[model samples]
Target: MREVFPDAGFREPVEAAEIVEAERRLGQALPTDLRQLLLESNGVLGRTRVATVWAVDQIVEQNLRFWSDENFAQLYMPFDALMFFGDNGGGDQFAFVQKPQRPDVFVWEHESDSRR
Candidate 1:
């Protein structure tokens, strides 16, 4: 994170209890690197003050909506396999593949509803 944003902003570190609950609610363990990052900072702010990474609570809320919201299903492909964590500040969002459980991250462009 620091490498990407030297002047990045960070919130207070997340507690272990919080991470445990978040994982439970999400029905899956968080990505290892993301979990570690959350332990160091609940969230990260980047250029133009965009939320480069969301807080744990936000992660839960946003994912819940993406994964189960019927409206989203009608508009786009299933989100059950992606764990979103951030955005590019222009509607494009970032996520990790959850079904296959890969270490690499992916970006979902809102306009095209594409992930790559």
Candidate 2:
């Protein structure tokens, strides 16, 4: 992360217990890299002018919000299968599609509700 965002500022690291709690709330284990990152710093900020990596709580909140939206609910069904991690200033988000053994990351476009 630092290599990609040299000027980034981060929130204080969250406790391992907190991460574990987040995982329990989300009903899935976070990817190892992401878990480690959260342990290092709950989130990244002031990286570039366009984005912020969300903290564990924010991730859960956003996912819950999206999962409950009438329009997005069906699209994001099986909610626990997706993990949102960041947002672009423009409203788009970044996330990972959880798989049995690993997660595949993608950029989720807000306007189209599509992932790529």
Candidate 3:
């Protein structure tokens, strides 16, 4: 993180207990790397002070809303396969593919509801 944005901002690490509760409530384990990152720093702020990696609470809330909210469901394709963790400081969000749990990350564009 420091290497990428020498001045990037970071928050205090979160407890393992929080991670455990997050997984339990979300019904899935977070990606191992992401889990470790959150334990080291709850979130990372990159260019323009945007959340390059969101806080654990934000991750849970966003994912839950994307997966279960009626409005999102009606507007976009099912989001259960993705585990969102960041954004581009714009409307584009970053996520991990969770259905088969691949190592590659994907970008979800809010405007078009497209993933790439």
Candidate 4:
């Protein structure tokens, strides 16, 4: 992260320590790729809502939607806002997730960035 994006913001380890512990309690692993991408590229990568590497998936059951933005957990907002979009199974791309509370966007089953 520090090496890739010099301007990327950094949360003191002490500040993020609790968040890390919480992830452990939930029995979930923060998406490593997504985290790395954000740390490497702290700023928004590409066009807005044009599909960089991910998308806000609401087509499925609302509860079933795996990716979301926790800050806007109110049920109507974008999740992949902070990360870069890659590729997805349905001809879409993937995105990196910053926090655990929000649903992170990623390439679906066999989707690839090239498809986009």
By TM-score, the best candidate is 1
RMSD score of candidate 4 (Å): 10.8
Residue-wise C-alpha lDDT for candidate 4, range 57-100, written one tens digit per residue: 22121212334436335543354333334432344435444444
Cα lDDT tens digits, model 3, 15-107, are 999999999989999999899999999999986899989999999999998898999889999999999999989889999999989988999
Overall local distance difference test of candidate 4: 0.37
Error of 2 at 100 (Å): 5.1
Q: Which is the better candidate, 1 or 4, if ranked by TM-score?
A: 1
Worst 10 residues of 3 by lDDT: 1-10
Tell me the number of clashing residue pairs for each predicted model: 0, 0, 0, 20
What ranking of all candidate models by lDDT puts the best one first?
Answer: 3, 1, 2, 4
Candidates' C-alpha lDDT = 0.93, 0.77, 0.94, 0.37
* lDDT at residue 86 of model 1 (Cα atoms): 92
The C-alpha RMSD in Å for every predicted model, in order, reads: 0.9, 2.4, 0.9, 10.8
Q: How many backbone clashes are present in model 1?
A: 0
Task: Assess every candidate by TM-score.
Answer: 0.96, 0.82, 0.95, 0.27
In model 3, how large is the Cα lDDT of residue 82? 98
Estimate, for each residue in 1-116, the C-alpha lDDT of model 1 and write its tens digit: 67867989999999999999999999999999999999999989987889889999999999999999999999999999999999878988899999999998999988889999
TM value for model 1? 0.96
Candidate 2, lDDT over the whole model: 0.77
Candidate 4 TM-score, true structure as reference: 0.27
**Candidate 4 displacement at residue 26 in angstroms:** 6.8
